[model samples]
Target: MELLDFARGPAMEWAFAIFIIGVLWRLFGIFFLHHRRDLNEPRHGGAAPWWGAVKTVFSRMWPRREFRERNTYSTVLGYVSHIGLAIVVFGGAFHLLFIRDLFGVSWPALPTAFVYLSGVVALVAFIALLVRRITHPVLRLLSNFDDYFSWFVAVAPLVTGLMAVAHLGARYETLLAIHILSFQLLLVWFPFGKLMHAFLFVPARAVTGYVFTRRGAAT
Candidate 1:
């Protein structure tokens, strides 16, 4: 099959299926595998658990004292890259049309030039983070195969996407196919890797907040 057909047809379908199934399986395993209950007495508590959880989740959006002092640059890079990539992927006019066709919903999209610029910024930030991971002793020590592999999978789409947009190194059809294929690979890798944190962090933060609130610590 042609690259375009394979990417848009079977490959895209496979990626979506694996993404949905893998996410569901991983989530189920997290909730069901952990059955231990905390039996320790609470130190003090006035706030509702739900309220504490909600508060903690939103409060963490602002950097903590330690993050600001110790890793402010890294934190800023993370925010910039993540937010920029999200805009490029979900706020682009082309992407909005695709979303509308697939899901029967539509929304305003950012201008194409802005979307392109955001994608470039996101790619640059991602590369910077990878360089930091490689150069920093502590981060390098903590890093493993999954970290690098996830980085590759995550960045491949951005690189190919830029190539597609610029019509560079190949025909546009081929570049678009490669871009879609890279995204599909990312979806397939998401569930088993640190990428799962995107989905897992919400509940994890909520539980952490609930526990902290029960212990009378400020969230």
Candidate 2:
């Protein structure tokens, strides 16, 4: 009937479907495209020992040692944005409600104040990332169309979510509609864009670390 009604109905369904399917597609693509490269072969090294690979990923985010050696402001911003967004997505009350409505699943939600704080953190981190991308020369040089598009696509939901909470501009329903629409766009673009890195990054990092460790380049 009305746009608000649609947002709470078909739009929600479509957004959830696209998100699930898109994530699956991206994971599948990464799994199929990358042959298991060996990490210890004499030339290229055989594959890293499985346990070692796991350890590498779990330890890769440490601020000291090799992780910090490679770090830059852009990396810091990216990490902060990802962490904040994960907190908001997994901890927010509205997200829990949406899950209950769509999937008949429920989880404990963060406190209302925490939900608002998480949203603000996610939004601030996202804006910092955007500014970093524009100002950082190396990042700018490395960025392609997909990189720029992915930033906006990922950030749009957070911005609209804040607006939705404040009931700014249009009603909450309209803000929510905009949020869901942006999320759908992100889902559709994910598999074909740099955003697929979300699915691939862990494995990729593991393989790199393993290769270097076996070669005595990383310790």
Candidate 3:
């Protein structure tokens, strides 16, 4: 179908181009920003800032003890969505095939059923997070258009891909085209949104940890 062709062709190419350029542009800006040297010497001896940075990145993966009670469910759902998305994207056979075709790299695929299960769980976990963002008093007060729009674009591909696979509500070709286009939407929005956090979170945590350690402050 012409629609499918366009979706798979120019739309995908343009979206991928925008994605790469935008992400590189942002990364270069961030990485090249001039950092003012700390004029003061480190306050804490044996703090080992580099080691602190590495440790903090891993440690921050889980909430601190005092915050665990209120954050447990939210944290669990976050991991569920993140892990599930990783599995579905990197381990699925079809996805791997796409990667192979695009970049000429190949890897072993997960079982099809497992990949589908991961996708379903990811969608559910992400939706739960979205609901919390909408209903939680502080979160809702702080939320803006970017938050909601990022969620929409991120979820669209997952929903459409599942629908396309299940042949729900449309012809196979049409559904496939919709799925691809939805993915392109995600690509186009990824670098310009909170979705950029996907790439920045690790560095952010590490940098914060290093700074806090050097100042002998609790993270």
Each candidate: what lDDT? 0.90, 0.74, 0.91
Of candidate 1, the 10-residue stretch with the lowest lDDT total is 40-49
Against the true structure, whose lDDT is highest?
Answer: 3
**lDDT tens string, model 2, 1-219?**
276677667776776687678788767776678576665644236445555567678876666564576565656777777887877787888888877876798889877787777778777878887777788788788888888898888888888877888898986667887777776677677777788888787988787676666665642
**What TM-score does prediction 3 earn?**
0.95
Clashing pairs in 3: none
Per-model C-alpha RMSD: 1.5, 3.6, 1.3
- The candidate that achieves the highest TM-score relative to the unseen native structure: 3
Supply every candidate's count of residue pairs whose N, Cα or C atoms clash at under 3 angstroms.
0, 9, 0
Sort the candidates on TM-score, descending order: 3, 1, 2
* Winner by lDDT between candidate 3 and candidate 2: 3
TM-score of each: 0.94, 0.80, 0.95
Error of 1 at 17 (Å): 0.8
**Candidate 1 lDDT over residue span 29-119, tens digit each:** 8878956777867765488767889898888876888677868778888989999999998988888888998899999999899999999
